[model samples]
Target: YSLSVAYQPSDDLNLYGRYATGYRSGGFNGEMFGSNPFFEEKVNSWELGVKSNLLDGRVRANASVYGYVWEDIQTAKIETDNGTATSGLVNAGEADRWGGELELMGAVSDSMVVGFNYSYINGDFEEFPDLCGVDPTIPCLDGTANAVRSNSPGNQYSAFTDITLARLGNGEISAFINVAYSEATPENALWSNLVANDVFPRENPAQIMDQRTLVDAQIAWRDIAIGDGMLTVTLWGKNLLDDDYPNYSINFGALNFITEQYGDPATYGVDFTYEF
Candidate 1:
């Protein structure tokens, strides 16, 4: 797909808009067993919005909304394992999803910047019914015995501020910090990959709304000269709060043969590079 942004000047306002086209292969809601493959979900989208550089670019803001349609969307389908009701992938039927967003970026001073952004999304199947032996209220996924990870949220948000710390010692050092947070989204909107609250039956699935908070920082020294180039060292870390959380769920997938290796220990790494 192609995406582009343009700004023009009118007597009363600064006009801004974005034009783009994109396509995605139908996301597989369940797994494909043996040699039998399934169909995919596809979408076509279009959108437009505007922004204003009010107060001489000191205060800038923008807003936009978009809509899309999916054809023959993949929905809940069934699979059998060893002549038994096992896990598998199926079309979610057909559907449509649409949403809109708003944002504002303002500069209160040469050293300070503030911003805010929000979005709302809504997606649903036009003809999604329960598969045989499955409940519409449960999410049916592949693997993990029975996991109910399904339909996700369409709402999102953000707000932030940044300050450029004044340079220090020969006016060469710079430092900055950022903070962000958001709402939890179910795997999608179905509360399950195929059906709401239903699991794939290879693993144990839980009803969870995935959301979390994060804070990060950086302190570095730069410009110390080596024999041939500048030497710079940076100390950085993520999820620094050491908050315990699930990074992702395993649904057997293509790696189902490796179930015995599921609960591996956490990881830590270190590196040193010299540019010459």
Candidate 2:
């Protein structure tokens, strides 16, 4: 079920609110773990937001705050027994989340524009208990609510600015830059702990992906006369700073080593197109 409301107090401003409920169907983890499946998960969400244009249409902004609760969340893990490993899913208990976002765009002039966006979220498991390992004597089951939810980033931000430099030969030349940042994130319990202080002293004691920033740039010429059509040309570079950040990492306890994947390095490309 869901509900929503909207109000416009002036020609330049609008307010809105919403409440919604959703469900996610759980399923088996992998063929290695047959016949067993995780339970479904449900969530209830609420949001309040506003949109406005200020400074005589030169600036526009949108912002929202939201909260949600998750029930019977499905979680997955891998287990090994006697040199064979299998993946399985289970119904972890409840969790709650809250977040907010703001987006702003401004026209510094008719020839230049800038935009920015930011988001923050905090989520955690409220109740969960599961086996820590294959050994029954290890006493892995414990009732605890302190586990940090997987894949939940606490903060993220991005911004972009574009400017039209000049007009020549019936075409406009523009340049733009984009930047993005993300806070460190918690790692999965499975691989994160295998290479902790007890094992790999060089590795992080708490499994986490370090904060990273990425930048991109582009220059383009548009509406150039080409025979009977218009032509556009663009030169672009991605990951311009050549940041070498880990895209993924895992510590295999059984193997006694950690593996990591790195993001793409700086790359450049050019594109040309003709429009009829």
Candidate 3:
């Protein structure tokens, strides 16, 4: 169930609030032999926000703050017996999360526009008692420790600009560029514990996703008349700075190894399109 309300105080400004309830069905853990089924999860959320158009509609800005109560959160973990590892899902427990975001965009002139966005989030286990530590021999169900929520980054930011570079014969040349940054995140229970200092002496850095900044840009010429059609040509690049960072990882505790996958390297390409 969900409810939301919005009030427009002026032609250019609005305020809103919302509340929602969510549910997820339970499922069995197929990977762990004879493993019990994990129960469903639930969440209750609330949010308040505002939106505005400023400077005669040349600029726009929006901001929001939100909180959530998550119950019976389903999480996955690896279990090892006699050096053989198996992964399965479990209902780790409840958690609380709060976050906020801000977005701003404005037209500096008739041919140029710029925008920025930022978000922050903090989440912690509210009732996670059965959390495993670095030792694989200790059964997760038998352990009692608080852990941070997995895959939750504390902060992120991005900025971009669009510019009309020139006017060509029957066409316009434009360019766009964007840069994004993400804070490091934990992968699972053990990794989360390391971040919370529940487990001392960091075992391996591979268990945590690394923070990184990436840049991407593209330029295009559009509306060129070509025999019975309009053509567009574009050149683009991604990860322009070639920043290296781990995007995903898996920790095999008893196996004493962690596997990681990295973000893509710098890439460049060209695109062509035609419209009749």
Candidate 4:
């Protein structure tokens, strides 16, 4: 269910607020428990935001703040059960999350434009018990809980700019550049290798991967004539600087491992499109 309200304070400014509720159905983890299903999860959220035009419509800005709470959050874990590795999903407990975002764009000149955006989020575990342990006689709540939520990054920011380089006969050529960055976060609640060894585990806050930054750019020419049709061509490259960062990492006493899930390597390509 959802509800929203909006107000136009001025001809160039707008404000809004919203409230909503959502849910996710439970599912089973075939890797560890073929038929046992976790409980469904639900969330309630609220948001308030504002949008405005400044500098006589040449500049635009928007910002918003939001918060939410989750009940019966489903979390997954990998463990060793009787010397066999297994993965399973469980209703870990509850969590509270909050965040905000900001964006600004400006037409600095007739031929160039710039934009900036930033966002931040924070999540906390209310109650989560370890269901997988070495001692079968001990209760699940005996020193088996977590404070931090997995995969929750605290902050991120990005910026982009586009410039019209030149104009050709009945066509125009433009170039653009964009850059993005993300804060580091925990890859998982427990280190995989330790859990696989049948030992009770706790996530180490100090053991974190480094942050990431990526850059990309593109140039294009459009509205060229091909007989009675129009043609456009574009040249582009992503992750242009080839910055290397670990998307996943683990420390296993003697061995350190990292997986580069930063996506494909730096690549450049040209595209052609025609319209009649």
Candidate 5:
């Protein structure tokens, strides 16, 4: 269920708020035999935000903040038995999350526009009691510790711009560029290698993903008339900087080894489209 309200205090400004409830059905962990089925999960969330236009709509800005309380949160983990490992999910208890975002865009000229966006988020386990250590031989049932939510980055930032470069025979040439960054975060929610220092044991370094920055861009020519239709051609590139970063990993401590998968390298391509 959800409820939302909005108000416009002026011709160029507006404010809004929302409240919502969410639910997820319970399910069994097919990978682990004799494991009890997890219970359903629920959450309550809310948000408040505002939007504004300045300089006669040439510049625009928006911001928002939100929070949520989650119960019986379902989390994924690796289950080991008799030297074998299987992936499965479990209900890890409660969590509290909050975040906000800011966006700004401006028309610097009739032919060019620039924009920037930033977002931040945080999540903490409020009642997780089944955390596990890096030792695959040790099961979660053997310990009680809190761990950060998996894949939840605390901050992200991006900036992008679009520009009209020129006017050619019945067509327009334009270009766009975007740069983005993400903060490092844990890849697994339950395994933190806490057996060593229980108080402040280091996380499984192999399971913590590294922060990364990526850039993508494209240039295109559009609106060339072709048999009563329009044609567009574009050239694009992704991960322009060719950043090297590990996106996923698994730690097999008993074997004294770990495995990792990396993000993609720089790549380029061309696209063609026609409309009638």
Candidate 6:
């Protein structure tokens, strides 16, 4: 395990940093491990940040940036046998990731508080070849020089806002709404090996995956007695609009391809619990 810490010297001016490392396991694909073997992957990540409370503790803000490098990134290797993806995880050579985040908070009044957050991320295989084309008719991944994996996205961003209200006597009721946004991203960094003879329509979505904006809301009621015990419940819903956008794409080379992706469908659920 990686050991690191963050230190804040003051309430008005705060600073912090951290260092961490993680491992990715190596594994064989049941589809093709019989003929091919694969290897494992690893990564090292580091980050730093600063936070501040301004306007006499009414306003608060924080910002942070991070970087990471991976050794022997596990990659999927495909073979000509039925064009099925069967190779195990192989060292993907190397890869890296870096990003930053900013957030702000404010106390509008004694009864209400508001906050906002934003984040951006950029990741690249750095060494993967762009053998995949831009058209929609590309057949299965060509075993040719064009064949590559590591389709991670290059740019991603998100924004969110939240609000909280004071509670009531026996039980408190607070409502919140949060909206988030993200830039389009590549489905994968490597050429798909789904079907051997299949030429993927496009290595990724015909274009960058579509950007998306999601809105969610929640209402929580807590600290109430139910019968002989205390009980609480939350009514929550996500993607309330049920916006239809592509969440992912598949390109098996020319043999098979799915250009459009199906995003999450809208749903609402309730959580209820009682303590004795």
Q: Which lDDT tens digits does candidate 4 get at residues 1-276?
A: 999999998989999999999999987778657788898999999999999999899999999999999888777654444455556777767778899999999998999999999999987776666543455564443212444655767888899999999988878999999999988887665433334444344333334555778899999998999899999999999889887766654444323433335456788999999999
lDDT rank order: 5, 3, 2, 4, 6, 1
List ranges where model 2 is wrong by over 4 Å. Answer: 132-138, 141-146, 189-206
Q: Least accurate stretch of 10 residues (summed lDDT) in model 4?
A: 251-260
Can you write out model 2's per-residue Cα lDDT over 1-276, one digit (the tens) per residue? 999999999999999999999999977666656777788899999999999999998999999999999898776554444445455677778888899999999999999999999999987777776435434455554434345665667889999999999989799999999999988886663221221122221212335777889999999999999789999999999999998887676655564556678888999999999998
**What is the per-residue lDDT of model 6 for residues 36-146, given as tens digits with 9 covering 90 to 100?**
455566778898999899999998988999989877766544333464433445555566678888888888876567777777666655544234333446643433334
Determine the backbone clash count of candidate 2. 0
Q: Comparing 4 and 6 by lDDT, which wins?
A: 4
Q: Candidate 3, residue 230: CA error in Å?
A: 2.3
Q: Which parts of model 3 are misplaced by more than 4 Å?
A: 131-145, 191-206
lDDT of 5: 0.82
Candidate 2 matches the true fold with a TM-score of: 0.88
Question: Among these predicted structures, which one has the highest lDDT?
Answer: 5
The clash numbers for all candidates, in the given order, read: 36, 0, 0, 0, 0, 32
Each prediction's whole-model lDDT (CA):
0.51, 0.78, 0.81, 0.76, 0.82, 0.64
Task: State the lDDT of candidate 3 residue by residue for 128-167, as single tens digits.
Answer: 6454455666455422244655677799999999999999
TM-score of each: 0.63, 0.88, 0.88, 0.86, 0.88, 0.74
Report how far off residue 260 is in candidate 2 (Å): 2.1
User: In model 1, how large is the Cα lDDT of residue 35?
Assistant: 45
**Which candidate model has the greater lDDT, 3 or 4?**
3
Would you give me the overall lDDT of model 4? 0.76
Tens-digit lDDT track for model 5 on 150-195? 7878999999999999999889999999999999987777653333
Choose 2 or 6, whichever is better by TM-score.
Answer: 2
